[model samples]
Target: MANKRGNVWIAVSGVVENENGDWLVVKKKYGGLKGKWSFPAGFVNEGETLDEAIVREIHEETGIEAEVQGVIGIRSGVIQSTISDNMIIFKLKANSSKIIVQEDELFEAAFFPPNFLKDDEDASLLLQSFAEEMFEKMLYKIDGLNPGDQFGYTSYRLFL
Candidate 1:
């Protein structure tokens, strides 16, 4: 199947925490965000759910298997009034600490201390703000409800 919607792109990013309370971040090797540190993220593929996309992206970028805890945030905006970019941010729990960064997509990958990005020069402002806000308050999350089939769409997940 082809992508019928060309103007809209959906992406997912995960904020994964290790057992030591360190957060996972990746440095992009290309694009405008080159050299900037942020959470592991990628565009969703056709037929992939947001949760599946985030988990896949996290593993693909950082080689860390993570379980989605819930959705933490969402960012949506229009680019040049032509393209719509929407990103879903998920909170994840890392299964292990060891990271094997993907050489093609990332410059580096590592776990950082809490609030590490707050004052970091190489971090994006949005990421910095997220770091601060995440630690400062309890975030409301949309969690998965049981029996996805109840919605009639087998792949549909109810988050509440």
Candidate 2:
């Protein structure tokens, strides 16, 4: 299937956690989200898989190599009544704690305790909500599935 209208945008984000039980967050350097703390995220490029996009985004924004653990959540909404945006949030495990922030895209990147974002004034509302929810309940995640050699697609990660 193809999107003939081209009005939809697909994005990916990661809730990355380190071994010490801290979460990774970054402050964007531009746009409406400038200076606000949020998880590393970006638009999924052409021909890229969802898991690949989340890992690439985390590395691009925070300079931390991470592996996708599972799919955490999905959010969809229409922006400005024209563009439909769909974002898939993934749970990631950081390979290393060291972060070399991408200066052009992010102002700062660091790991913080779970309770930090929920009360931080600079954190985005969505980030705060996620943090609060994480503190209160366990997030249901969809692990990757290895389909048999039946499907001809290059990659398949269905939330089942």
Candidate 3:
């Protein structure tokens, strides 16, 4: 079966882990995800490579200069009927941990540890699960995915 070609709006995100295995995330201040914590991500701009876009997004959103460790995974969500966003996520090593959140769109940017009760802090369950799933894929390198060939990460369907 051949897949039909349609417009897939592609985006990129990064996973910058601290030495203690915590994940860096941001709280959105606009749109549907307002106040919910998520990773720093944005659309791949025209004339920019995915790598460059992810790095730029991380810096712009979190003020973190991240060295791309490897291509870790993929995340996708559909918006209504026509707009579907596919995000390519990478694993990064922070050159520095300093974060300067873009207050216009995000309220706070910080690292949150894993396996903690997210509901207590009002973090998105889906986003937390997404982080955990990507972490596991990064460790196991399942489907023979490497740093460069990172498309085999995982898929997600977000309701809101």
Candidate 4:
């Protein structure tokens, strides 16, 4: 169900990095990535702007109020033979640290430090591979705006 761009669907995600550089990832309760970790993301609803969709998805999946900073990166490719996958990655500044998991879609959400997928040890090869595939390389950088410059995100983890 793509929009006017001929894409199959639009997947919007928010990339929020903490002061310690750890990334916010969620453990899926179902789907292919069930029990695995990934960024807080979801499909863009009909008649919703990218900005609105990203913020809504983040809050719906993980209880984080984040302000859209700017575009981080985007990846578009083919999936399942003909299905078009258009993924837009946006950097968000979390205004709060409270993490109230959405029980229906996700079971747990946490911040994983960068390089959690290191290949040095004999940890789980599959997990490492998944992490690499999910977030192997970042194609963008940021300047001027720090992690929590505008928002008052004191910590990445906040108990509800």
What residue runs in model 4 are displaced by over 4 Å at the alpha carbon? 1-7, 117-160
Give the worst 10-residue stretch by lDDT in candidate 4: 151-160
Q: After superposition on all CA atoms, how large is the RMSD of candidate 3?
A: 8.6
Candidate 4, residue 107: Cα displacement in angstroms equals 2.1
lDDT of 3 at 127: 61
* Order of quality (lDDT): 2, 1, 3, 4
Judge candidate 1 at residue 51 and give its lDDT. 89
- Give the candidates in order of TM-score, highest first: 1, 2, 3, 4
lDDT of 2 by residue, 1-160 (tens): 2455478989898889999878999999897789999988988888888889989899988889998767777889987788898998888889988899999999999999879888999998778878888833234445456677677667666654
- Which candidate comes out best when scored by TM-score? 1
Q: Give the TM-score of candidate 3.
A: 0.73
Can you give the TM-score per candidate against the true fold? 0.86, 0.86, 0.73, 0.67
lDDT of 1 at 118: 79
Winner by lDDT between candidate 4 and candidate 3: 3
| Candidate 1 residue-wise lDDT, 1-160, digit = tens | 2245688989898889999888899999997789998889889988878889999999989889998887778889987878888998888899977899999999999999757687899997667978888643224444455555556654655444
TM-score, structure 4 vs. true: 0.67
When superposed on Cα atoms, how far off is each prediction in RMSD?
Answer: 3.4, 3.8, 8.6, 10.0
Residue 47 accuracy (lDDT) in model 3: 70
Candidate 3 regions with alpha-carbon error over 4 angstroms:
1-7, 117-121, 131-134, 139-160
